[model samples]
Target: MITIEGVDAGYGRLQILFSVSMKARSGEITAILGPNGSGKSTLLKTIFGQTSVYNGSIKLDGVELSGRPPHEIARLGIAYLPQINNLFTDLTVRENLLMSGYMLSEEERRKRTEEVFQLFPFLRNMLHRKAASLSGGERQMLSIGMALMRRPKVIMLDEPTANLSPKMVNTVLDVVRRLRDDHGFTVLLAEQSVVKALRLSDHAVLLVGGRVLFEGDPSELLNNKELGRMYLGLGGG
Candidate 1:
């Protein structure tokens, strides 16, 4: 499990999160839903060690990760996929996956690469294709596959469905679900597609101006008409 307690973080001299706290349970999808400038991305960056934590603690299964660097955090079984530039566009799909697991032995790299290919079978055929040649959805898939090469326990994705067709949105969400159901990964997704994300997630965190206004089962957010309307722009259920 990933836990954040009283976390205050942001870019240097520009704090975005305000003592925020939340928990992403093991083998479950936790959706962080909020409006623009609400510090959703900043929170993920803080967890990944891209942002500075002015106060509080972040832990994964009892190990303190508050002051660690991003690479160290990744080594601690946390994988972060930002909204863009997550893939090496000029590299072949196979090369990108290989680079993601460069620290592993050749045998382990090959084994993990095959596992990722199993998760995204379409990439098996496009092994030699440069990442830039793929469609938006396929690029996203490849980005995720690269992240999966390390087989981290927690995968944090910032806007996985951004700027995609509806079909692709569903495809990405389905993969997120599979990461939990089939692979036992703890998935943390920050998404703008609130309704869709809420439908697919087990828990939801509603953020506004860097504060967590609500955190509980998605059904609780969906059923609260006022909270839904105020934060999510959803009509009364």
Candidate 2:
């Protein structure tokens, strides 16, 4: 449902992504795996309009999105949950959820908040608590829950499992899988943890030096020792 073609994006006068192209299909969990500085996050930002796309095009459901603002992208059913600084730490859990739906009407906001709470019941009990007081895992859950408050068609998560405990990581991945299987939401996840990401994804894209090194089912990556060792530093054997 999302297509990025030959996208080049970077900070002012400094390019990070170079002609990267990929597609995330509806009803699939596509994982973007790469080592640090591989321009994986840049690809997401360029698609979401957070970075300027100097060349090529990003299309959501067949409409071009190159010059649109980030909020416009959001309104088109794309939600981006970045690796860090996604929420207002000082805001209460309920307040944060409320903020995510500010673009919707009051009745729509309440409806969406209930839907998010259904996905993450733990947040329901902590509605009055400050976001900063929650544990790291809880914070991450909150971030994802807030993104769900928008009722997006495509949810793009950048390193959702990053800094959580092992159990928490499993919890987050379980939620993501359920989001795809049960809720039918299209998921595009960018992660550095190849093994965990592959375990949860339906498809994989390997990126290096701001380009698509490989793109296919996870088995292609998990079965290739040479590719894994060369790009990801994992012995794959």
Candidate 3:
């Protein structure tokens, strides 16, 4: 499980999270829902060691993640997939997966690559295609396929469905579901699509202005007429 207790973090001197505390239980989908500047992205970044955490702890399965470098954190089984620039656009899809698994032996890379292909079979045929040449949905598939190479215990996805067509949104989200359901991977999803997110999440954390407004069952936030209408823009809440 990923645990955060009294975390205060941000870039340099500017703090975005304020005494943020929450627990993302293992093998479940934890939705981080909020408005644009409410620090959803910052919260994920804080856990991944991208932000400066002035106070509190970020622990994954009892290991302290604070003060660790990004690569070290990654090595420890926390894989972060940000909203943008998630892949090497200059490289081919095959090359991108290769780069993601550089730490593994060539034989292991081949094995994982096949596993990725099993999840995104379309990628198997597009191995030589440059990441920049794929469609938005296809690129996202490749990007996520790369993350899967590590076989991480936890995957922190920052708006995995962003900038995709409506159909593609569901497509990407289905993969998010499989991450928890099929692979038993813990998922931390930060999303702006409130209702859709709530529907998929097993647990939910509502953030407003960098603080936890609500943290409990997904249904609690979805059923709350006031908070739904006021903060989440859920119509007729």
Candidate 4:
């Protein structure tokens, strides 16, 4: 499991996350829900070592991760996909996947690429196409495929469904579910779609002003009339 306890982190001296504590359990989806500036992305970045951590601890299965660099954190089987700039826009889909696993042997890289293709069959057909040419949903698919190439135990996705059609949103969220349910991968999703994300999530963390306002069962958050309507944009039922 990925555990965070009293983690204060941000870019340089600017502190965004204030004593953030949470757990992303294995084989389950943990939805990081919040308003636009609620620090959802910061929490994910803090865990991935992108931001400076001032206090507390971040541990993956009991190993300290706060002081480690991003590459070192990634080598620990954690793949973090930020909201933007996740893909090499100039590179072909196949090339991006190859780049993700360059440290592996040639044969192993090919094998892993095939595994990613099996999970996302459409990627094989679009291997020659540049990532810049693909749609939002397609880019997300390619991004996830590239992450899978490295075989990560934990996947942190920052709005995987951003800027996509409604249908594409569902499609991407389904794949996120599969990563947890079928592949037994731990997923920490920071999403903009509140209802869809909560419905699919096993656990929910509601962040407001860089603090944990709520954290627990998804159902509880869904049923919260005040919070749902006030901040989450969920209509009264």
Per-prediction TM-score to the true structure, in the order listed: 0.97, 0.96, 0.98, 0.98
For model 3, residues 1-237, the per-residue Cα lDDT tens digits are 999999999999998999999999999999999878999999999999999999999999999999999999999998999989999999999899999999899899999999998889899888898999999989888888899999889999999888889999999999989888889999999987788889999999999899999999999999999888878888982
Q: How many Å off is the CA of 234 in candidate 4?
A: 1.1
Give the better candidate number (1 or 3) by TM-score. 3
Per-residue alpha-carbon lDDT of candidate 2 for residues 148-187, written as tens digits (9 for 90 to 100): 8888899999998888888988988999999999899999
- How far does residue 200 in candidate 2 sit from its true spot (Å)? 1.3
Name the candidate, 1 or 4, with the larger TM-score value. Answer: 4
lDDT of 1 at 198: 94
Query: Any residue pairs clashing in model 3, and if so which?
Result: none
* Residue 178 displacement in candidate 1 (angstroms): 0.4
lDDT of 1 by residue, 79-137 (tens): 99998899999999989998999999999999999999889999999999999999999
Clashes in model 2: which pairs? none
TM-score of 1: 0.97
**N/CA/C clash count, model 1:** 0
Once superposed on the true structure, which residue ranges of model 3 sit more than 4 Å away at CA? none
